[model samples]
Target: MSLSVEEVRRRVAADWNGIVDVLDEKIALRSVSAEGIAGENMERSARFVADTLRKVGVDARVEQATGADGKPGAWEVIGEKIVDPDAPTVLLYAHHDVQPVPDPAEWNTDPFVGTVVGDRLFGRGSCDDGAGIAIHYGALEALGDDLGVNVKVFIEGEEEMGSPSFIPFIEAHRGEFKADVIVVADSGNWAPDIPSLTTSLRGNATCDVHVRVLGHAVHSGQYGGPILDANTVAAMLISSMYDREGNLAVPGLEGCEPIGGLERDVDELGLRADTGVVDSYELAGTGSLASRLWTKPSMTVIGFDATPVKDSFNVIAPECTFRLSVRVSPVQAPHAALEAIQVFCEEHAPFGAEVKVTMLEEGMGWAMDPDCAATKDAETAMAEAFGTAPVNMGQGGSIPFIPELQRIFPDAEVLVTGPEDPQSNAHSPNESVSVSGLEKDVVAEALLLDKLAHKPEPTNL
Candidate 1:
């Protein structure tokens, strides 16, 4: 017997506690894959993901692939359950790893513990992608054996580490992954209550710039007057990336045009709590709020190396470095944007302070064809699941693996959907997901899968 959408929703509601318990367990894994850390619990998390999928009726297994650096990457939980040979297959994708907690003391609650307070479930990966695993599980469990389409699951374990081995792994096993539709449960909605289909994603480009101003260290008290310190020169270079108005001044960088009927009347004041901006701090940049976040290039000096105030020294440093992270427009190439930044940095060098740049990470962005038949179906499913009209939105974040998936499977229609909200604060301390929104996400995915199963033949569907 085919399970109805109403039945799926009811099952999601009935099994909400189980879903939370699974999420909490996943959170407790400490599956952090960041910096050079290989994530101690990555294999365990992958096994747990595979077991969860197996229990839910999917034939799943844990797999791993060697990255370009010849090092083994994180474990991948892969499986498939084909209902019909001729039916279109839908690929369900999520990651099983979480980000490292740089400092647990900054969090209001334990970063590895899924603490539920009111409607929010707080944890490091609760909203980012751990909840994503639960969403897929809930949908499959609720649907039972009545899916109209085949399902393939790929739970990545190194997504938090920029998916270093994603390309090689997918290419090595390319034959195992061919789908008519791909659902990426890694992006969030417009708001907690507003359901959104992520239509575009900004790519990322990063580089570290080093500035040298002195040949040797000197006493600041003795040589501070005539010559500027290395830290001061590095600050000047950083300042060149933006204008006095606070907009990024890097030339040749790209910005996407605003979408029609999609420009939001942003309530900056209303979002103060979400942003946690300090009092009297004004927002920067130009253009619509949505455009600024989703389309245009945004740059920040994420890390700086200089002197430590506590380890104070009267010495003038000879060199300093700052790492710049850029989110390029979805349509712009990450390499191209990075090249522009390199040129801008060289040309805008202050006091001819021997500036040098070293490229770090670069990733291509992705955009979906919102007019596709699968997208149309997804909209209806989300609308029904949430009882409100859904919106097509763009995420400012970068999902490097997505564009690669599109490139490999040119025929598949990819959908970026998830349970995160603006307040989720993914990748930061006290990260969380809205409990109610997450429940709706389960229902939405189930409904979307059911709709795809019953759709017409795979003709750009």
Candidate 2:
């Protein structure tokens, strides 16, 4: 059975109040899954998700697995709504864990309470994935019993911590996670009225480089003129990675030409204000702003080790270490990029300083088919809800698990979507989700489900 636009909108409007209330309740859970938080919070969050799924006729339960570290993984809410024994199954994925609030004082409203101010809801985890949970819940509520396909609701509890047990959990319960389509509602949108179907995600890797100039610290006035400090040598190493325009000068780390041709104006997007960059600061790399943000490679010094000002006594440092967080193209292998960085550091050793490289971590990038049957149906549904076609976009941030999921289920159509907009400051102070935008997301998803149920044939560009 096909549902009309008017029907979908009416149902969404009727159920919106409960949806917002559920999102608010989730935001207050404090289900942080960082390195050192208590484990009970994750369990509590899992229970909450399982209970919510049951309300919508899903056979849900809480499950957990052991990680590679030989410890318990975060609790995962796993369940299913099998409308028919022989129908296609769609998997709804979202994370209930949140990034820890760095400083509560930085927030205008309480970090855990979802407060509606004007058109936005302000709180931690308000948009990042809380809205995502609500969208999945709201769609099921709107569609009631005529769901075209079966659904498996997998609400993870530790996505913010890199999904350490995700693969292992799948290994333990692979059959339940299988589906024809997977909707990952964890990325962002282009605007409140405009949707963004994320088609690409950059891969990520990190490394630490150690530079040793002197065996031990020495008086600056005595040896400073003849020798360079290790700190200064480390600075030289960082500069060597970029050219005059600040584009990456390293070879062997590949970057692809821009895809989708989606141009972005930095000023209108509030890029400067979002980053709190200084006035007249020139942008790094060469290309359209969209290309730089999505398709190109970027490396930044995330951590530095050196003497502090309070401990400074005008001494030439003996050795120093700095960490580099690298973002590479979806098509490039992260290990290859990390190897290139290591080779560059060894070759460009400033002043012949002894160098050591330790590759920290790496995650593969991903690219999705924009012309698939499910993608076309999603575009049609989102257009009907928002009165405009969704833009095909790419996110620089890496999800890591998407690649693994695709590898396990090669034929499944993976669609990345979310309610976050440019103003949704996820992982920062004053994070929020636009109320109107979230409602649109619910309607769009409900409509997409209706289309997928009826149009099961494959379509391509």
Per lDDT, the best of the predicted structures is 2
Cα RMSDs, all models: 3.5, 2.4
Q: Which ten contiguous residues of candidate 1 have the minimum total lDDT?
A: 257-266
What would the per-residue lDDT of candidate 2 be over residues 363-431, giving only the tens digit for each residue? Answer: 998888877888888888888988888876888889999988998888999999998998888988989
Angstrom error at residue 25, model 2 = 1.8
Q: What TM-score does structure 2 among the candidates reach?
A: 0.94
Q: Model 1 off-target regions past 4 Å?
A: 1-5, 28-30, 33-40, 101-115, 213-230, 258-266, 307-319, 456-461
Best by TM-score: 2
Count of residue pairs whose backbone atoms collide, per candidate: 0, 0
lDDT of 1 by residue, 312-366 (tens): 6888898999998999998899999989988987887887878888898898888
Candidate 1 global TM-score: 0.87
Clashing pairs in 2: none
TM-score of each: 0.87, 0.94
